[model samples]
Target: MQTPLDTLQHIFGYPSFRGEQEAIIDTLVSGEDALVLMPTGGGKSLCYQIPSLVRPGVGVVISPLIALMQDQVNALNELGVRAGFLNSTLSMEQVRETEQALLNNELDLLYVAPERLLQSRTLDLLDSAPLALFAIDEAHCVAQWGHDFRADYLRLDVLHQRFPQVPRIALTATADVRTREEIVTRLALDEARQFVAGFDRPNIQYRIQQKDNPRRQLLQFLRAEHPNQAGIVYCLSRKKVEQTAEWLCREGFNALPYHAGLPAPLRATHQSRFLREEAVIMVATIAFGMGIDKPDVRFVAHLDLPKSIEAYYQETGRAGRDGEPATALLLYGLEDVVKLRQMMSSSDGAESFKRHEQQRLTAMLGLCEVTSCRRQVLLRYFADTLEEPCGNCDTCLSPPETWDASEPVRKALSCVYRTGQRFGANHLIDVLRGSSAEKILSLGHDRLSTYGIGRDLSAEEWRSIMRQLVAAGYLDVDPEGFGGLRLTEQCRPVLRGDQPVFLRRDIKVPTARPAARRAVEEIPEADMGLWQALRACRKRLADEHGVPPYVIFHDATLRAMLEQKPLEPRQMLAISGVGDSKLERFGADFLDVIREFEYTHS
Candidate 1:
């Protein structure tokens, strides 16, 4: 019988288990349940994959992502694992064939969508077959308040009820404290052992800027830092996704737009292109990239603010999954917040849900305006601790200046109050800046005491103060009216002049890309030639296999080949990603490349 570690090294070709993977695998292999909250690129799949290989029968994985299931099975089949998936993408004949494989115990792992898994025919088929253990990928989807909620997931507890003997493991890349609790309760995993690795992705550098000419800023960031690299640019709406993608294409980029409103076939084709091709920028709304397995996505840029930190983390995490240096950039305007809040206010959710969502949005706004380390704030939100400030964020790289806004905040608040606390930021700024607009003159005789009180400051300066005041809890958006500003109870002290208030002053980053600590992997000229050769070979093989290039062999694996320059078959087996199957299948082709390079260079 192969042990879990033996299966890992022999089949998966990983020399060692990462983080708590070995422990999680042990729990599952011993017929116990487990809940895992590991970050992206943290090797969550191996926690269940190894146990399935070591145990009897096929591992039944319940996932909501059809594309993810297909991608994983393709990658697993390459490693000589007998993996199959049952999803809508399959034809009726293919589904029956996959089902037969599971029943015959010919498959080591089987991926099924939550809807398909809940079907009575599928459940009955599973009843007749022996089972290793159930693995629930994206377990957070079971939570009602999760970012990617699936109604079918709410019925997943039936798995525990149906198969009381089979061990189960639930895994997700990102889930906050509330969502974690919800998953546990929803999935009936009360007795399961939980393994939570750190939420930090150190390879990703976080950068957020104010949305000043957002398209221009995005273009500048892309051209300067990640030219011709594979990345995803997220937009707030379908319209913006289309516009941004078209504009990027016009500016000489291979960009594609993806949103739910598009035809399903078109979305699938766009996603397929993004996965298969190089240097493709996917401009998508939140509708895309739930379970994308593309490993070489170099950056994730947000043209507008995300709904909350969890959504932001989940989206940005799509980049740098291969543990290479990547970037997460966000450019947002205050209007984004107002529009989001209004949308939330008008949603059909219950009051409690609205309140919780409001809190999350408040925290997100605070992150956008914070002067301290953005990574630290992000980790704290997820109930993870980073004792020291991470130096890989915008604030850490170029710390923002703080100004004592005691007097200015008081004026901003006074202006809101004097305007009956029912006017929006623009109106308040106009009143504070002493604007003589027709509407202002029409509303009053222009004799009010608070009129023109803030004339000493520029309109932009006054607008910044109002924005900060709303974000800092000194003022709140009035839900009763049309995006008006009202004072909150938390602002009583500052309003009474008892305590001081300080705010971070927004500073524009230089257009020239700084030679800062933002990780940039600079390949030497000598290694570039061999690296290109290895990549070309992989791309050629991937096209033949009808899968993504990363599915064939990750960039890291290719780089290992370049660095080691393996000569013989046995030397190729020493590579990190080379299992028995890959060595027998692809060892010769890669070794041939290495030999040619050595002969030419020597």
Candidate 2:
């Protein structure tokens, strides 16, 4: 039997197992169940994939998304492994063939959806087959409290009852303590070995900005910070997705919008374009792109705030998957908070569900508005402690110099009260800035004693102060009204000058430098044209096979071959990202390209 390290080198081409991958795999292969909580991009797939190959019988992988299953199967098959998936996308003939293969003991791994796995026919087949192990991908879905809960997932516990002999391994990229416990209970893996990897993705720099002309801010971020890089911009609604995509296009970006509302073909096309095209920006709602395997995503921008830190972490984890530096930018405002609260209130769950959802939303808001190091707060949410501040986040990068805003906060609160506290942040800002907006005049807010008293501060400065005031518990948004600003009981200390409020002083805006558009590292001069030709060939083959191009040959593999100019299959296998499956599947094709190139160029 090959050790996990040997399997890693022979199959996946990675030199070694990353972090706890070996430990988890050893426990599973030793015929014991395990629950693994690994961060995204932490090589979670390898833990199961390697064991599936090394273990005796066919490995049954229960996954939630059909697209994710397809991607995984295709990638596995590219490495010369016998992998198949049974999902809604497959025809009857395809399903029958896969079933026959499994029964014949000709397949190593089979990816099935939870819904399909629960079916009578499928369960019966699995019972007859010699199952090596049962792997649950995205295991957090089994928990009702998890953000992406599915009814079918709740039925997965039956797998344990039926296949008590087969070792079960559940894996998820995002799960807090509550969700983790729920997963363990729901999956009946109470005694399973628990492996919790650290949540830090040091390559991703986190940033949060108060929303001000979000589109403009996004455009500025793209143009000034990360020009011409693959990225995802998340919006809360489909309309916003479309609008943001259009705005990016108008601004000369190679961008596309993807959401469930669009036609399936269009969404697939857009997703394909993002995968194959270089530097494509995908504007999408949460419905699109989970378990996406694309690497080299340079940034993830959230135009609207995510509902929970879990969602935010998972979404941002999609970026910088290749272990490169990336950015997670969030644009948040008070309206986002109101919208989230409304969503929670309107949800059809029980009171406990509503309360939990509200707490998650509140945590997300706190992450956005917290004055401390953003990374520290985020890691602490995942039960990880950071002894020092991560100097990459916005707060850390540009440390705000705070001043006493106690009088200004009191003044703002008094003005809200004098105006009956019926106005939102914008109107309150207008009152503070003494703007004679039509609404202010109509309400006679201009005559208030606190009105115009904050003239010393700019509109932006006053808005920041107001946000801090709300965040610091001196004020609250009225839930009954249209999110009107109101003074909280905590406002008393500030009102009487008994407390000091330190506000972040706004700095002089610096001249913006044009964002550096880093070119995708080119194949060496000797093999540049040949590498492009190989990539073109790979894409054509991928299209014919109906698989993602990366499954054919990752860009990294091509670059390696170009630099080393590998002459044989064995030599090619030595390249990073080129494993046995790839070598067996596409080695001959790649070798043909290299041979032809050498002959012509010689």
Candidate 3:
């Protein structure tokens, strides 16, 4: 019997397990249960995948998305593993064949959608096989309060009830403290050993800019910072998604729109293209990218605010998944917050759910407004602490300036109060800026003592104060009053002049400046042609195999090969991602390419 480490290198090409992966695998291999909380690209699959290979029967992976299941199985097959999936995408004949494989013990791993696994026929088929273990991917879907709840996921606990002796491992890439507790309780994993990996993605640089002509800003960021890199630009709605994608295409970028409203076939086509093509930007809403396995996304840009820290973390995790340097940029403003709060208030969810949503939104706003490290604030939400500030985020890279906002805040709050506290920020800003807008004159507010009290501050500056005040809990948005500003109890001290107020001055990042090019992009001009040749070879092989190009060889692996300039088969084995299977399969082809390049150069 091979040890887990041996199986890892021989099959997966990775020389060593990452973080707690070995420990988690050991627990499951010993016929014990486990719960794994790992960030995206943290090797969560290895925790259960290696154990199934060493165990007696096939490993069953319960995935929530049909596309996710198919992608996983395709990647596994490339590793020389006999893997198959049962999902709605399969025909009746294909489903029957997969069921037969399950009973015959012919497969090392089987991927199943939650809905398909809940079928009585499938459960009965599994009863006849010697079970290895059950792996639940995206376990957060079982939590009703989570952002991506699936009713079918609730039925997953039946797997434990049916196969009492089979070990189970539940895994998720995103889960806050509350969602973690809920998954353990709802999935009946009380006894499973828990593993929580650090939520930090050091390779990703975070940047947030206050929205000003958002379309122009996004275009500038793309043209200057990301030129031809593959990325995902997330929008707040389907309409925005369509408009943004079209706009990007018009600007000569290979951009596509993806949302739930699109036809299923079209969405699938766009997703497939994104996975297979290089430098394709996917403009989409939150409905896409739940469990995408694409490894080389160069960036993730948000045109609007995300609903919560968890959602933001998960979405941004998609970038730099290959462990290469990537960027996460966000553009937000006062309207984003107001629109989000208004949507939350009008949701038909239970009152408790609405309250939780509001709290999450508040936390998100706090992240956008924080003067300190954005990474620290994000991790703290997940109950993880980073002792030092990360130099990767916007704040660490270009720290914001703070101003003594006491006098300005007092004026804003006083204006809110004097205006009956039922008016919105725009109205208050107009009043404070002494705007002679007809409404102010119509409301007879020109005669009020607080009118034009903040004339010394510019309109933009006052707007910043109001935004930060709301984020700092000094003021609250009245959902029922069309986003009116009202004071919270937390603001009493500042309002009564018992304490001073300090706020981070919004630092405007000039989008027109050229983004610093990545180090990899500085590849020697001589080697550039060879690099493209190697990629073309990989693409051809991938097309022949009917799989994503990464399945043949990840771009990182190709770069390593290119830089190392391996001339012999033995040299190929020494590459980082070259395991026994891959070296045997493509070593000769890659060596041929490298040998030709060397001969020509010499």
Candidate 4:
């Protein structure tokens, strides 16, 4: 009987369990349940993978990511774990063989779609087959009000009713206090041991800047820091995704567009290319990144605002899955806030749900406007806290200077009041900066006392003040859904000159600050050739096997090979990530590259 640690070292090539992994694995292997809330790339998969191997029967993983199951299974097979998946992508013959394998106890782990797993036929088949436990991935989908709700996932509690004795482990990367409670209620995991890991991804530098020509900003940022690296660029609309992808391609990047609007086959092809190839940038909508397993994504850039803090966290969490340095950037504007408000107001959810969403959006906006460490506010949203400011976010890296906006805010609020609160930021700015625009003259607002009083500040500066006011609850978007600015009760103190106002000075021509985590592993000039040769060997093997190069051996493993310069097969096994299966399969090729390099250098 192999222990969990033994399975981890011998199979997954990891030396020790991370964080609460060992605890979670023990609960499951002992035939108990656990609900895990670990961050992405925090080794959530191993909590179940190890228990499945150590326990007697096959572990059943229920997830909605059918498109990703094949890649996961392929990676597992490379580790010498007998893993298989049942999804629409497989033919009937293949499905039959998999079912038979499950019955014969040949598979150590099985991945099943939530819909398929809930079917009566599949349930009956599982009843007769030996099972270790059920592992539910993306467990937050159980919350009806969650950002990524799936109706099928809400009924996952059926597993408990049907298989009462089998242990169940539910896992998710993003879940708030409310969502966590809802997950416990819906999944019938009332007694399940809960493991809540910290939500911080220290390797990811959090950055949010006011939108100023987003395309140019993205291009400059990429050219400056992340050129030729794998990344995801998120757009709010399908059209924007396509346009950005095309634009990036024109700008000499290997970019592709992915959206639900695309044909399914085309989406699959683009996804495959992004996964199998290096340096591919995927321009996509929210439809693209759920359950994405790509490990080396260096950055996730948002051209627009995400709807909530959870959505932002989930989207950005996709980067740096391999625990290397990464960046999560957001470029937003006042229009983005209005658009997001309109989106919330139009949703078909219950009033309470919509209000909850609105609050979340407001918090998201606050995050963008925050003057303190972005990481602190982000973790606090998930009920986790960092006592000290994280030295990794935009604010912590380059603290913005604050201005006393006492007089400016009063004038801005008075302008909104005198104008009947029917005008948006542009009109208000026009009124403030004394524009000779037709609408202002048509409305005869050029004669008003509040008009033209703000000429002391630039239009951009006024815009920044108004944006911060809205974010801080001093101003509200028109309740009538007219996209106009209105004064809130919170502004009364400022209106009476009793409150002092402060705001961050928005950066003009903002500089690109890349992720401030540790640098990439250095390969000396002499060792660079062997490094390239090893990567080339890995790429060729990955292409032949039809899997991603990382699954062959991650970049970290390749660097270890470079640093250690392992010359013999026995020595290769001593490197981390070199298990018996991979060492047997690919060790000779890497050793051959190292030997040739050494001979040439000597």
> Pick by TM-score: which candidate is best?
4
The residue pairs that clash in candidate 3, if any, are none
* Cα lDDT computed for each candidate against the true fold: 0.89, 0.83, 0.88, 0.92
Tens digits of per-residue lDDT for model 2 on 172-250?
9888888899998888999899999988887788888787887778878888878888899999999989988998999
Which candidate number would show the highest lDDT if scored against the true structure? Answer: 4
Clashes of each: 0, 3, 0, 0
Ranking of predictions according to lDDT: 4, 1, 3, 2
Give the better candidate number (2 or 3) by lDDT.
3
Stretches of candidate 3 exceeding 4 Å from the true structure: 511-521
Writing each residue's lDDT as its tens digit, candidate 4 over 493-593 gives 98999999999999875564643757755678977888889999999999988899999998888888989999998889888889888988889989999
Cα RMSD for candidate 2? Answer: 2.9
TM-score versus the correct structure, for each prediction: 0.98, 0.92, 0.97, 0.98
Model 1 RMSD in angstroms: 1.4
Q: Residue 26 error for model 1, in Å? A: 1.0
RMSD of each: 1.4, 2.9, 1.7, 1.2
Candidate 1 lDDT, 416-458, residue by residue in tens? 8788889988888888878899989999825667788889988
C-alpha positional error of residue 436 in candidate 2 after TM-score superposition, expressed in Å: 3.4
Residue by residue across 1-602, what tens digits does model 3's lDDT show?
88999999888887788789999999999999999999898988888889999998999989877866776788888888889999899899998888888888899999888898899988998999878999999999998988899998888889879999999999998998889999898899999999999788888888888887888888888887788889999999999999999888999999999999999999999998998888999999999998889898989999999998889999999998888888898998887888888999899999999999989989999999998998899889999989999877788877889989898898899899889989998999999888899999999888788899999988888888988988888898888888898989988899899999999987566544323224344667888999999999899888887788998888889989888999887778878788888888877888898999899989
Q: Give the TM-score of candidate 2.
A: 0.92
Model 1 vs. true fold: TM: 0.98
Off by over 4 Å in 1: 514-518
